[model samples]
Target: MSASAPICLERGDIQGGILRAYGKRGYPRARFLLFHVARAEAGRWFLEQLRPRVTPALDWAEGGESVKPGQMTRPEVTLNLAFTFRGLEALGVPLRTLKGFPEAFADGMAQRDAVLGDDVGPNRIRFWDPVWHGEPGRAGVHVLVMLNALIAAPDVMTARLAKVTAEVVGLAGETAGGVMLLEGHRGADPRWQELAALWGPQPDGRMGPLASEHFGFNDAIGDPVFDGQYPDGAERDKCRGQGAVDGCGNWRPLATGEFILGWPDESQEVAGAPMPLDFSRNGTFFAYRKLHQDLASWDVWIESRALMLKEVWGLASLAEARATLKAKMAGRWEDGVPLVKAPTFADWQAARARMAEMTRAEQTAFLTEFGYASDREGRMCPKTAHIRRANTRDALDPLWDAKDGKGRLGSALNNRRRILRRGLPYGGRDDPDGEHGIVLLAYCADLFRQFEFVQQQWMNHGLDFDAGNDGCPIVGAHREGARFVIASSDPAKPPFVAGGLKPFVTTRGGDYFFQPSMTALRMIGQGLVDPT
Candidate 1:
């Protein structure tokens, strides 16, 4: 029989970040705290901190949300804690747990920040943020506590978050055995800086806050639904139109282990678990990345290029030309509407209106339900579109099996490499060159096979994806003389190749950390988690 859903998930032990799409839940107020373990029994001390407010997956489901129509009624908060390689050792994690984890993670992302320069062999780190590259003495980041606040507006956010944050440190009149790492220390209170309290986007709006980031796109469009969670809690999603479709014609949810630990992954193997099964069970590796987006340049480039694209597209207006280029680059419009579903901007208005009127489930199915198999020739959607490249759902077939054939392989490969993206935009719509962009947290079982592989093989390079040296349009760090070809639907007219492309997204700083289970947290608190 096929692997069943849930797969005996220890939901009580799992961190909510692994399952909860904070952005989707209207948890806009988020602050990432990086701490250093100062005490010898830092693990024990840290666990003490986690005891009060570290919301677990199961608990969150039962009583985590106070959501209303498009906004959270009261300020609800969630937490997920991760430890650096040094932090784990400082916490006295057992040797077996230490040894059982993936080497890429144990070694940390500081060791493996892949860089690409067109003629890539082994490239050095492209992103050299002082915060990420500095020594431990200077950097001092050990523990990562992601605190997400679900508040309707900014007026009530500050007080609620401050109370929740203080709960961690003020527990039993003890220290967390670490100083927090803040993004900025100037013009801020000493306590805030000490907590490393870097707050993200504070939503404000008429009909609730519009769910979007600096780029004006509907951020966190289709957070891939996993096995444990479904539309109405029990009924499965239909294949015809839904959020994410498997390579198979049937549109089903991804395997539970794709993000959650200790369960059988797409390959039908229980992924790597720390020595004591409970220690790693329900836990997953996390990559916390701070990515910066250059908007001024994007406007300048888009405006100049749209004029050039007018001739290529045979368009009357610059708006049409601009929209077409944006859609081609993003694979979706700014509203998070995929171009594969509606190839032209003209058709998008009705689609968007229809979506707004749809039931939540119907909206998800319509927005997420799409594939590129029908658009193989790149007529509707280009081969090098950002979303197409990022996802590659049914785009490339996995190792073809005589039994399963072609379709199953694409989804099979996609399932194993999936990383749950849970993070928020960090700056406003216009932040010239300020501290802006996204603090992306990717949760996965295997770091190299899932996150790094996608970054290097798919995002940076294009050979394996069959686009031939074509980097992704939006974020792909294309070398000089880089070009993106928009395939023509008409046989007579040739494809339009838009060259002179530069990288829009640049990595600011990031690291790899392991989010352990609540049981493990308790063990660490008790100083009894000895894998050795």
Candidate 2:
């Protein structure tokens, strides 16, 4: 491992050990505890301080060094912390959940442009507060801290264990933190209700009922299936290959059973895992979608241009729509490879035959490069296409190392950010008026560097800061009239016909969080945060 990467534990090993420990204690199942961080800086500081305080008894591995460089492995501690609205206040920083920030930022940017009105300045900075200034109570910071420890004792023993764990970590008397007991099974313990009541009304009212159901089992099954598949085949293929696709699809009916919990009135069990809670738990990402499900209409607006879908994708013919969609995404009709680089249809099939010869990374790199260069003329890939805007390596190639003696500037922003998109389609076929849409979930190390920067600076705005033009075609949001437009480099050819988006996916809720080491959780429980 390199010097910069942190040591990580295998998630399976940790989970298995936890389950075994819980089983040995006679508990039917294991329960997870969640914590929320208020501030990013505070979280960083707290984790840094608590690293040493974490005990070996809680440590899953022996002699695993603290996070070192070049380690792609999971952390020795398998703990995930979510940042929340209340936690943000503690950090003294503005808190904008994912849902509020993007919309508010888009509105703010539009307003600034409107005020400027044709005299827009050159790359000026604009600040917008989506939560505090736009939506008041609707937006708040929320982070869910997740930890798995063996529940070895009965009610009385478990209470003693909780107190002992708290005291062992010096968390017995701490005002800065809150503790809420989590029961594995409600039927086995009457105190579960009392503990649930103490947490107060859940901020989103989704957690309580979700907890009442089969806590560990629900998570074990629901986390992977809903977050991994349900929408994107590419993601599903990836998860299945990794063996993360457990038996969750079979649990949907049971999800709404009397024991299962959900939102909008608790009468309906949530169709999928609850938001934020299910995010990234199963080594998958959550795709958030603001679907306009019209129960009255059984019709859906899947493809606005059905004719184009028929013409371009050859769907409605013998080809399946899903297969055609995947083929189009690959830039080829069938046999693999891309039409842009292949030109002749025969070459595409040849490329597909050679798929076994190349590594996965090689294929992705090949596609990325081909798409980047081919879109210049907007003949192969439209200049305004989502894929084109995202991977601008060819465009930035000329400016990569060019600098004005200050810092690295004028180059491809591709290396700076990349997103692993995981989205699911919501609203059943019963809904009409185009109720179906994608819940787009993306994961990246830095929101500013990856997602927000791409959306605001490149995709939505059409300027790369370093590279120029309206950003990505597929996902970028723009104002009416003054749409951020892209034109092909080839003047003789027109840009691929692009359409405006209705901000299809809105950020309803989100928070910045850190998935910490298990040792870090112990420190947190012990109140190891420094006074300084």
- Choose the strongest candidate by TM-score: 1
The lDDT per prediction is 0.66, 0.31
lDDT winner: 1
- Give each model a TM-score: 0.86, 0.43
> After TM-score superposition, what is the CA distance of residue 122 in candidate 2 from its true location, in Å?
29
What is the C-alpha lDDT profile of model 2 across 434-490, one tens digit per residue? 333322334433344455555555565554423254434233333343222323233
**Candidate 2 wrongly placed segments (more than 4 Å):** 1-79, 88-141, 145-350, 353-375, 399-412, 419-441, 464-471, 478-502, 517-519
lDDT of 1 by residue, 34-137 (tens): 56566646446656767656676652322556643323223277777888877787777777677887788877776775432312321224443454554646
Instruction: Please give the lDDT score at residue 77 for candidate 2.
Output: 27
| Count of residue pairs whose backbone atoms collide, per candidate | 4, 42
**Model 2 vs. true fold: TM:** 0.43
Q: List the residue pairs that clash in candidate 1.
A: 181-196, 182-196, 242-365, 242-369
Off by over 4 Å in 1: 1-8, 59-75, 115-129, 167-207, 230-235, 238-248, 398-410
